[model samples]
Target: MALFFFLTAQSQNKDLPDVGIIPKIVVKAIGVNTDIQGIIKNDSNLFKTLSSELIIISNMGAKNASKAEQKDNFSIAPDEVKIVATKNINVADTDNIIVLFLIYEDEKLIARDRKELRRQKNDPNVSDGLEIKGLVVENVRSKVGKDFYDYFYQQFTLKNPESDQLVKVEEQLGIGIGTRIQIKVQEDLVFESFARPNEEQLVNLANSAVARVLQYFKQKERQKQLLRQF
Candidate 1:
């Protein structure tokens, strides 16, 4: 059997500069399980410290950075995601920026990544910018050449058009292979299917997830274009 769910929020940024009614953006960090605990293992202090780091990096030195904490609305579920924090900042006169994240385990640096930030400078754009943080997963149960275990669950987060909000999407499957299913799409989309049966299947799932995000934007653009034409 398989199951899936999603959540969304309507948030706004209050720190953007008023520049003669220039467009405003709701920057969001997107990925799978990018919470504080997801990056590190078994460390609370480190999680808090990294949480601060994420907020700072997302701000990109803008005067009005978000003071929200990282653990806000975050939970320990199979794959539940939320808008952990929100920042009201200016994006005027800046082409783009780069944010760096460092992941460590047991006081040792294990992984690192550089995130690129570029404003969406086109009409019909849902938000000004989208930040692709990365993906993190845990609790994998496997055995040598055997698929005889039990208890399987997975979760992920989806970014909505509104600022300071995230769509927590999750799925659960156990004991058998099943067909993929696309549940629904509104401000947020939820997709549930059987667990990946192989590496190729996993890649397909990842690609489908990315396509869903792109499709959301495309739908937004379609709405905007129709309104303009009318």
Candidate 2:
């Protein structure tokens, strides 16, 4: 099983900005009406701003399996939030969900977020419990391994403390085979090193791993921007 941790601010990737689907469900005497909007956020401190070419695709669905979608373009400055796509649907009930997608340059998918629209009848205190996760560590053992884990944690935390970046330090062990360490960011392996190296070597490996992780994310950011230019 994969472990879960949460770095708030954006999607599972720190490379792209955040696009959230905010749905307000109103219960009428006859049926229900849902108003959903896409809230795009850009953290200039961590990422670049999204210009007018950014497209937000909003999808609204109900328990009856009916789906509706809206698309629009938007621009948001760094350290700013703007509402993009607005979709109002007459849903059958409060059992609904909104999925907002950010398509960069119409070809690449940069980011997306989802929210459930629900209401409990006659229960005003019902809460829609949502769980979010960030930064995961896997199968770390022994003092050597612990040292590596600690170092990677400190370095990554300092680099991206407020990003929803999923980080994993996976350890592979078996009989007669060399152990393996793979540090991954957003499901992409950034560094795979240090089977059974010495303590000093392990520290160095951690340093490389952290640097590779950051470099990988930085490269992703640049790649998306290049896609936008052409």
Candidate 3:
């Protein structure tokens, strides 16, 4: 018998996907073999049915620096815990070993976790997103506004993806038959439009809104960082 320890590292920049499906990884040492299980969890307020890949990567610290990897694809839904993977690995002589777990949703990297005997390698550098503040307030008073909002919500959450931010979508009666729409980040206005376009246009409109909002926060972040140097 030998002594071993497992240190876990979670996703740093992102959380459970906005779609609400997240993967949970479990590891247990059974005799000389390592047991790894993958579980999916669906959180609140979002309805999503998705298939994802659960990847298990292990670093065997040896002369060759070899790595072992296993991947499996599975479908998951709300409130259901489907066993994605159960892998049994044999740990060799040295105690220095690392096991990394990743879950990808619709080919998009969504959640990850790692269990290690010790911190041998730094977690892969994940690009950080600007933390957003304020509440996401929607003022949809008409059918047009509602249509735009639907398009915007789906686009905004996926494109580039903000870490912690709230977006306020406001609508007002335009001077013409169309209605006015605007996106506000806290008090700063990032996107505004008065044209009442069709559904096709709404897709573009949503994309633009997502871009403007990200730009607004990104610029503010740069300014804050610059001021901090003083």
| Whole-model Cα lDDT of every candidate shown, in order | 0.33, 0.50, 0.60
lDDT of 2 by residue, 1-230 (tens): 11111112334345664443221111111134434445554544544333222222222343356555555655555543445555555544334344444445344556654444433344333212211223445567655567677666544543443334678888876445446788887687788865554765766787788788777777877898999999
Question: What 10-residue stretch in candidate 3 is worst by lDDT?
Answer: 126-135
Candidate 2 residue-pair clash tally = 4
lDDT tens digits, residues 69-97, model 3? Answer: 66776655554445567777665443455
What's the residue-level lDDT of 142 in candidate 2? 56
Clash count list over all predictions: 1, 4, 1
- Stronger candidate by lDDT (1 vs 2): 2
Residue pairs of candidate 2 with colliding backbone atoms: 5-133, 5-134, 6-133, 6-134
User: Which candidate order results from sorting by TM-score in descending order?
Assistant: 3, 2, 1
Off by over 4 Å in 2: 1-134, 161-163, 174-178
Location of the lowest summed lDDT over 10 successive residues in candidate 1:
144-153
lDDT of 1 by residue, 152-185 (tens): 1111222223322233334344455542333234
Candidates 1 and 3 compared by lDDT, better number = 3
Error of 3 at 217 (Å): 0.9
Badly placed stretches (over 4 Å) of model 1 are 1-166, 178-192
For all predicted structures, in order, the TM-scores are: 0.31, 0.39, 0.44
